[model samples]
Target: MKIGDPLNRSTDHGPQNHKAHLDKLLEFCQMGIKEGATLVYGGKQVQRPGFFFEPTVFTDVQDHMYIAKEESFGPIMIVSKFKTGEVDDVLRRANATEYGLASGVFTRDISKALYVSERLNAGTVFINTYNKTDVATPFGGFKQSGFGKDLGQEALNEYLKTKAVTIEY
Candidate 1:
């Protein structure tokens, strides 16, 4: 789903499912923190009842690090600042990972956005937005992230078999 709304960021102790999911997410987040990514925010789990966790952010993340390279699949975000004119740097960092399911480009320059969009080795690219989704769009990852597309018309092709029809004319 496209995550346009403001996320809890921290573990939501108010909800049971939120706590459970946040707990698993915490493990992944801390792993990244330990690996050297800066913990910009939300590093600790709430001591009170429920699965309340702090909303965490990581900065100064290196591209080679496990946290920066892997998909956290959580509320955590690792941000790396880049120069104003150097879009290529960000593109390289974003495309450096093994997983290439989707990516986002935020810029005012249309040409730069298009250039990065075209150069990025991902199946899906969104300009100026992150985690945007559509019912008609296909979603999946490349390399070790796994194979096959989910949702949309591409989903129908997953179980389909191609047959060659031959006739003597």
Candidate 2:
């Protein structure tokens, strides 16, 4: 993606939220290389004035790799191949994580997508899409990603303090 001016109306993407995040993205890119993942595309900074990192894609990523198991919050996509009918194994590997903020499943079969998304530990699951959310839908992570939400009714509940009460005769 193009790291252009954020204020520009036509800008597709912008710089990272922070320099530390950009540094971590660069570090993860290098870590992927050190861990034997093939750098398919874009692993360097944009060489611009801002903290902009290139969208990186790595192939041959293993489940045991640091980049695979760690919680990376940048534009990095790791590819691990599995057989067509091995959805169970894929789910196991996908759920084998301490942080579960979000996960994605791109499949033509609606039933399979529903089945897989339900089993994923992530709070947000995208079927045939990514990073797409609505204000009406609850958004939050299940594990170490976070405990609260930022949008919808779930976010409103964060401010609530309620307890159960009962009276019997």
Candidate 3:
């Protein structure tokens, strides 16, 4: 889907938040190219008004690639193919990141799915589905992704203070 004026209900998507963010996303795209990751799809600015950038996709990504290491926070997907039975290796690579906001595991094997969910450093792990969040569920990240959480009871705690009281009769 191409980016267009977000005000239009027909538009599937819109531009980045601002120019700086757009520039950063562009930089990541270039870094993906420079780091030898195969660009499978869009990687250029839309050349229109606002900070529009193409939704990008990169395949054959390496662990050391910038696209693989850092979070672009943009409409970019980096795919790293692994050996058929190398779940441990994949988990290690996924957890090696400094940011641990979210992760997803898609598999028919229940045991494998649970194992990956247990080992991933991200705070949220989606099995079989992606980006499924609810107001009742706490959402946040681990490591450098930031502290505390948002939504759910956990988020409510952030703005509340607990006080202990004792009564003697």
Candidate 4:
């Protein structure tokens, strides 16, 4: 697979949603570099007609870096390393963000997976996978990410109001 025109259908990659999103993605990539994070992969914008950014990856990301603390909402991944014994601190750093939308945990140990998932503040936590959403499950965010659900019975409940009536017989 190669990066080429998405319209070809065979191409493995596509452009960003728009120019603004592409620019934002580029900015975050630059910020990652400026903040001393190592750029492990692509970090350039393609010269094609539509807005496109190279899929990027950053290593040695710090908790305080803008690229680490904020969501890029683009095809960028930041890898932050933590000590094995610092699970508590890592959870705190992960939950410190204003957005509590979704999170993922990839681990072979079920106990560790459950432990972290239980502590993460995000509304959706995926174990051993990522971004697994279904119509059968309620979907929403906590904190500034947003409120209320959009699917499942929980979403249906939003428009319905329960009423009670009492009659003396």
Candidate 5:
């Protein structure tokens, strides 16, 4: 796909923030290929003047694969599959990763979504969406992703002070 411009109203995607990040994303895409993941789509830089990369997709990925485990911080989709009746097993595998910055879940079933989202070990869990966050909600990671929040009420609590007084009953 073409690199989208943020200023343009019709643009849906944009280039990577910098050259180094783009390079790193390419490396991870390549690593996924070498590690036996199937490159289903767009694993190369677009023929343009900016730090643009094709939104890459890797299928046939195992839960243990590095691409599935690490964050690319770029436009990359790593797909892994689980049996239909084994969602708990899938959640277990998803939470096995040490990093818990963000995670995405895509499903039509809201009940199933709530069920899976509750068990995910991430700071922010998105349903049928990614990279979209609300400023009024707590945002941070649970494990090695981070220690503190950057937005929402939890961040405000850091700057607030509350004291309780005991009353005779």
Candidate 6:
């Protein structure tokens, strides 16, 4: 297995709340996995002896699939290809989802990287890293993914309300 192989399932698995439609999630993953995407890691319903999944990856995934549109909580990744010099294509695909949490752009071209970082429609855009977090940075989801910021100093502001009191002196 590689350093980030999907087959290396986490042992801390358990029943998750079906707040986001489990059937839809499964369907999305299946559609992507079936469309030439290799299931390298996770696609199991039950852990059996342990709460672990196969940790899967789907390479060569096709666009317009549900997996590409939705977010998977497990260790499932879909690697898709786009035309060279077609940054717009990637941008469109990346922004097609209702969820806008975090995104990353990896490239040597500084201009292209900056452009993508500015236009990804995500709350946090990392130029060359995914899941880079900081206590001083604001974090939140957009659209159906939910709202309200968390982390950093700004987190406290979200839970606060301001009021102006009038007094006659």
lDDT of 5: 0.85
- Provide the overall lDDT of each model, using Cα atoms, as 2-decimal numbers: 0.71, 0.85, 0.86, 0.83, 0.85, 0.67
lDDT of 3 by residue, 1-169 (tens): 7479889966766999999998999899989899899899998889887888898889989888888899987788777766658988888888888998887777888888898899999989999876667899999999998799999999998999899999999
Model 4, 1-169: lDDT tens digits are: 2567778856767888888988888888889899899999988898777887787779899998998788887667677766669889999989889888777787788898899999999888888876566788998888887888889988998899899999999
Candidate 6: where are CA atoms >4 Å away?
1-27, 45-55, 165-169
- Supply the global lDDT for candidate 1: 0.71
**Least accurate 10 contiguous residues by lDDT in model 6:** 1-10
Q: Write the per-residue lDDT of candidate 6 for residues 47-132, one digit (tens) a residue.
A: 34433344456766666676777777654656666555788988887887887876667777788889888888887777766665
The best-first sequence of candidates by lDDT reads 3, 2, 5, 4, 1, 6
Better by TM-score, candidate 4 or 2: 2
Which 10-residue window in model 5 sums to the lowest lDDT?
A: 1-10
The most accurate candidate by lDDT is 3
Tell me how many residue pairs clash in candidate 6.
9
Q: Model 1: clashing residue pairs?
A: 11-53, 41-56, 42-55
- Per-prediction TM-score, please? 0.67, 0.84, 0.80, 0.75, 0.76, 0.70
Model 1 over residues 1-169: C-alpha lDDT tens digits? 2122235544232322576677677776778778777787776665666555565678888777777777755556567766767777878778778777666677788887898889987778889877668778988777766688988999889989999999998
lDDT of 2 by residue, 78-152 (tens): 777766699899889889889898877877889988988999999999888776778888898888889999899
Candidate 5 residue pairs that clash = none
What is the TM-score (0 to 1) of candidate 3?
0.80
Off by over 4 Å in 4: 1-17, 42-49, 52-55, 161-169
Tell me the deviation in Å of residue 29 in model 6.
3.0
